[model samples]
Target: MRARDVRAILFCAVTTLILLIGSYVLLQSALISLALAAGWLAWLLTRPRMQRVIRRLRGEPDWNGYFRND
Candidate 1:
């Protein structure tokens, strides 16, 4: 709906596309290409910035706020 959301989606699409094509070209295996793309995405999502963005998108409380409350 939002521009930021659209940009994020586009980024993910492009990243996955590049990874899939690159891995497939290099290794010539569909399954391995998919696996590598998934692995790459999983790694990216685990990053602190991505985690915070995901939490915020889910309407969850921030780590700083939670810590200050305790």
Candidate 2:
């Protein structure tokens, strides 16, 4: 893997840890924090731009009708 990919993964992991820790600290409940995180992730994944990215990753036809092999 490239250094860029490694950095991106680490960034995402740290951000997620911070979010979980912050959420727990503010909300005072593990379950609620987890739920909030799950909801947030769902919202992100369902966004149009993310959907396009996901489709591209899954080898689906893109917006311009270009087929990817994944």
Candidate 3:
């Protein structure tokens, strides 16, 4: 894989591992896990490049469906 792809994969793997460890240390509280997951998702969503990639992979017509095209 390309360096960028490898880096992205490493980042995602590390983040997932960290979240899993955090959840375990928190005694498997659903609320805490859900909150962490939601926050991570929100952070990803706010990144312009990630949103564009998601829309592209999902075959979305535009990044902002109700507004202007990306």
Per-model CA lDDT versus the true structure = 0.77, 0.66, 0.64
Which candidate do you rate higher for lDDT, 2 or 3? Answer: 2
Give the residue spans of candidate 3 off by over 4 A. 1-14, 26-28, 60-70
**How many residue pairs clash in model 3?**
0
Ranking by lDDT: 1, 2, 3
Q: Arrange candidates, best TM-score first.
A: 1, 2, 3
Tell me which of candidates 1 and 3 scores higher on TM-score.
Answer: 1
Q: For this target, which candidate reaches the highest lDDT against the unseen true structure?
A: 1
What is candidate 3's CA lDDT for residue 46?
Answer: 68
lDDT of 2 by residue, 1-70 (tens): 3354355446555766787899999989999888877876777667665566556557766557533344
Query: Whole-model lDDT for model 3 versus the true structure?
Result: 0.64
Q: Give the per-residue lDDT of model 3 (tens digit) for 1-70.
A: 2354356556766786688678868767877776887787678656775555556556766635543433
- For model 1, the superposed segments whose C-alpha errors exceed 4 Å read 1-9, 63-70
Model 3 vs. true fold: TM? 0.50
**Stretch of 10 with least lDDT, candidate 2:** 1-10
